[model samples]
Target: MVSIGTAEIISTHDAYHSSNWPALKPSEKKEMEKRRRIGSKPPTCEKKCYGCEPCEAIQVPTISSRPHLSHYSNYKPEGWRCHCAP
Candidate 1:
């Protein structure tokens, strides 16, 4: 069993990630990894709302119908900078 940050990650099987879906594709794995990394960053209280501009512009995309990327969004935290850069 390995500890990530304050969370205790249990071994899903004899090996790490053994519980991961068998059909998970390479692209999905990479995206999951990227998100996992981002969730660990410290909050940016001073930065302006992403406003669909993406903080890093490396991943987050601009979607017309999607919810705005701001502290008030339902899925993200306030003061949390957008994953994608401007």
Candidate 2:
């Protein structure tokens, strides 16, 4: 079984500009990295795809961030560089 509620969301795409956001201190960065690496199984069925399973899971590894979708595939990350938290 996998749990999806772990990290707190800090910002959104519209608000996430590197210069304006608060920088992650080394300790905070370390903690976030630990949280990001904690592994879990994938969701049985993705929110974006009613029937399709998620194909990948990667960590964005910049402070504490979720996957960014460059293109829409049921609103989930598709191919490379997709940092999808399980």
Candidate 3:
């Protein structure tokens, strides 16, 4: 069986000006703005794995400090486990 895993930036920290907000797409920027207006703190990032049976799992990394999104852009899921079923 073949399993495919994908990683995506779900939301960024509230430290907008200090992060890579300027480099984000227009749509992403809009979403962030909306979240901020609603006083919601978005996760740093998200990851998921998909198998033949459509199994789903979510993993969130821990951020020791408020780093730039640029750092997250290069994040590596070294020890992540996929819960996809065969």
lDDT of 2 by residue, 1-86 (tens): 23459955545544455447698799998987777774543433335444335534443333224345524334432232333344
* TM-score for each candidate, following the candidate numbering: 0.27, 0.25, 0.21
Instruction: Output the worst ten-in-a-row residue range by lDDT, candidate 3.
Output: 42-51
Writing each residue's lDDT as its tens digit, candidate 1 over 40-77 gives: 45455334443644444122334435455454664643
Decreasing TM-score order of the candidates: 1, 2, 3
Model 2 per-residue lDDT at 77: 26
Clashing pairs in 1: 54-84, 54-85, 55-84, 55-85, 55-86, 56-84, 56-85, 57-84, 57-85
Total clashing pairs for each candidate:
9, 2, 0
- Record all residue pairs in model 2 with backbone atoms less than 3 Å apart, i.e. clashing: 58-83, 58-84
Whole-model lDDT values for every prediction: 0.53, 0.48, 0.50
Q: What are the C-alpha RMSDs, in order, of all predicted structures? A: 13.5, 19.2, 20.0
Model 1 residue-pair collision total: 9
Top TM-score: which candidate number?
A: 1
lDDT, candidate 2, equals 0.48
On the 0 to 100 scale, the lDDT of residue 71 in model 2 is 41
